[model samples]
Target: MTHVVGEACIGCKYTDCVALCPVECFHEGPNFLVINPDVCIDCGVCVAECPVEAIFDEKDLPEAQREYVELNLRLAQSWPLITGSKEPMPEADAWAEKSSKREYLVEMV
Candidate 1:
């Protein structure tokens, strides 16, 4: 199975995980990042690097965040692939500990 990027990444948009993704499975949106399930190598390298702890193994995804599994898959198809690290959103630190950020997600660049 693949890894999933959940709501914890919505506004944070930290790219720490992107740099370590061996398979280049990461996709970047205006305010979030997603893992392309079809391409992910399940290397688990991205998980520990994610400062916000947003990455999760598919089987271990929290019940409340299960929808993120599909969200990542669908959005990855359109968001540009991100193979390198980039700056986090300006409010990243502030949003890192915030919850229920699903509504703040931006699907476009």
Candidate 2:
């Protein structure tokens, strides 16, 4: 079991979760974060740290966000691991309440 980072993280990219991740399972994309399933211990520590409420347990992912299970796995393979907290995207606040930001997710840096 692993956690998945969903669309709510697309534009926000909040790093609070990173600081609390004991395994450094989070990967950083240009505008998003993904949890590496292979590395995640499924402790669920990152879930609450996310301001956008984007992190979900693999088994608990919303039906609409179910695709994120695979999305997180695929992206984590290419993105760099994030082990420390950092500032969120400049427009994080503006993008926080928006629900359909999947289209804004940047796969590359």
Candidate 3:
């Protein structure tokens, strides 16, 4: 199964996971990072690097976090993969500082 990024990652869109991803399966959203389940090799490398412990194996994810798995895969289907690192993007802390636990809002979208 694939790993999912949970509510804890909201706004804390750290690129550490993205950087460690071998297939470049991780994608960026307006406020967080999502994994492309179709492309993910399930290496678990990105999960280890997440400072917020937001990543989870699909089967291990909490019931509340389940939607994130679909969100990741849904987002992956249409979003482009990142090929290179950029400069001075929003830091995890910066995003975290302003992030709200908005998992419920995702359903409204």
Candidate 4:
């Protein structure tokens, strides 16, 4: 299983999680960050570093954010790994607020 990024991280896109990630499982996406489940060591460092409290253990994820479990993996596969500091994607705030109503919350995996 992998940790998931929830809605709170939408506009924030804090890289603290990325910095603390031991395996660098976090990847940059078009509008948000994704976690590579295959690469995640489950060290839980990223989870703690997230300022918005968007990260969650797969098994402990709330139902509202359950889609993020798959979203993380799918987005990570196609998106590139962003090393060093990352800038938050533009319009992340708008996306985050609407993600709950998005037709495709999680890309098909």
Candidate 5:
């Protein structure tokens, strides 16, 4: 199964995971990143690269974060593809440790 980008990624938006993805399945939103389920290779390489541990295999996703599967799919279709590394949000370090960030998600670029 494909990997899902969860709430921890909402404001952090670290691109370390994006650079490790062989298929370039990542999509860039205003303040987050999503994996295009159709394009993801399920390589699992991006998992450890994530500073906030936001990436999870579809089958291994936490119960509370399951909705991110659909969120990733939906947003990936509309957001621009992100194939390389980039600076994260200015407050990424602060946001990374904060919980319940889904509400901060931005649907657009």
Candidate 6:
């Protein structure tokens, strides 16, 4: 199964996972990153690379975060692919501990 970027990644937008990804499956939004399910190789590399522990295998996703599977897919279609690591959002550290960040997600770049 594909991996999904969950709500914990919304404001943090850490790109460590992107750098480890073998395929150019990650897409960057204004404040987050998503994996393109169609291009993802089902590799678990990105999941361990995520500092916030926001990436999960689709089958292992928590019920509370299940919506992220669709969200990642939808956003990946419109956002630009991210093949390299970039500095995370300015307040990444501050946002990392904050839960329920779905409301802060920015759909556009």
Residue range with the least summed lDDT across 10 consecutive positions in model 4: 100-109
Residue 50 of model 6, lDDT score: 92
TM match of model 2 to true structure = 0.97
Give the per-residue lDDT of model 6 (tens digit) for 1-109: 7999998898898999998888899999999999999999997988988999999999999999998999999999999988898999999999999998888898876
Superposed on all Cα atoms, model 4 deviates from the true structure by an RMSD in Å of: 3.4
If the candidates were sorted by their lDDT against the true structure, best first, what order would they fall in?
5, 1, 6, 2, 3, 4
Tens digits of lDDT, candidate 5, 30-90: 9999999999989999999999999999999999998999999999989999999999999
| Number of clashing residue pairs, candidate 5 | 0
lDDT of each: 0.92, 0.91, 0.72, 0.71, 0.93, 0.92
Let me know the TM-score candidate 6 reaches against the reference structure.
0.97
Give per-residue CA lDDT, model 1, range 62-104, as digits (tens): 9999999999999999999999988999989999989998889
Better by lDDT, candidate 5 or 3 = 5
Off by over 4 Å in 3: 84-91, 94-100, 103-109
lDDT of 2: 0.91
Answer with 3 or 5, whichever has the higher TM-score.
5
**Which candidate do you rate higher for lDDT, 1 or 2?**
1
Which ten-residue region of model 3 has the weakest summed lDDT? 100-109
Candidate 1 residue spans exceeding 4 A from truth = none
For all predicted structures, in order, the TM-scores are 0.97, 0.97, 0.79, 0.77, 0.97, 0.97
Candidate 5: which pairs clash? Answer: none
Off by over 4 Å in 4: 87-109
Residue-level lDDT of model 2, residues 1-109, one tens digit each, is 8899999998888999999999999999999999999999999989998988999988889899988999999999999888999899999998998988878888886
Q: Positional deviation of 69 in candidate 5, in angstroms?
A: 0.6
Question: What's the lDDT for candidate 3?
Answer: 0.72
